[model samples]
Target: MIRVNHRSGGVLVLAVTETRLTAAVAPQFKQLVLDQIEAGNTRLVLDLSEVGFIDSTGLGAMVGILKRVGSRGDVAVCGLQPAAAQMFRLTRMDKVFRIYDDADAAVGALEQS
Candidate 1:
């Protein structure tokens, strides 16, 4: 589940409500974002501030989302909890996605793009 907020300049901020993003939830999470993309929301800021843990499956889902958006739009991540941040770093996914300290910064950057 995600809390959706529509910001200016066609930016969509999706705050993940789950504490753990693992195999059990990755599929649904991926689908939800894909659905949003299908609905014309290309610019996205995925707020993972509330997600304390993320597994390989979760990371895969995020990657899938970014690939889905491709060159048509951007997908940035913000407010990563320590564990999630570490995972991103360890996997070097930090380089794959735009990361920000908070939703505002991510949204601003996406809006500018």
Candidate 2:
């Protein structure tokens, strides 16, 4: 299951709770995130602390979300568990998205960028 917790303060934080972010579920999650981004939201922080794994589809979903926000906005990820964090590193996505230890750090990174 995937759960996105939305927060304010010029930053929209999405907390994902799922064993895997694979093709089976990435699309739905992508749409949900897209909806949030389109709703006048600019800064975003995706918290993957509870997500145990992420497949290529999940990576693609994140890339799509980043594109949706574009350079006009910023999107960072936080709290990625070890497994998911490894995948990001393997795919070089860790370099793509600004990653931090927690939501506050991500928000700070984005604000500073």
Candidate 3:
């Protein structure tokens, strides 16, 4: 579901390969993220460059992932497609998550902290 690249400075870049994140895949997505966190990745960058569609469940999964990180670390998102970006804005979740235009930039920001 996601390619977890463990970077330096405790930053993990998660690149989702799926184009659509709906109820069917949201659970799996959430699990994948949780698994990554449990594997010791706290600083995260969720790269949604390939995701073109996302439903409510997908949004929930994203929020769930953020919650999973908790006080231990943090999660950021990057490379949101136009549709996904609009959906996040509509849901006002854009304000809740740190966003970046590129994955490296997100990881850099997370690592710099």
Per-model TM against the reference: 0.99, 0.89, 0.96
Estimate every model's Cα lDDT from 0 to 1. 0.97, 0.84, 0.92
Candidate 1 lDDT (Cα, whole model)? Answer: 0.97
Error of 3 at 63 (Å): 0.3
lDDT (Cα, tens digit) per residue for candidate 1, span 1-113: 89999999999999999999999999999999999999999999999999999999999999999999999899999999999999999999999999999999999999898
Question: Where does candidate 2 have its weakest 10-residue lDDT segment?
Answer: 1-10
Model 2, 1-113: lDDT tens digits are 44655554677788776778889989988888888888877788988887888988898999999988998688999998888889888989889989999988887777676
Clash list (residue pairs), candidate 2: none
TM-score-superior candidate, 1 or 2:
1
Ranking by lDDT: 1, 3, 2
- Model 3 CA deviation exceeding 4 Å by range: none
- Candidate 1, residue 72: the lDDT equals 87
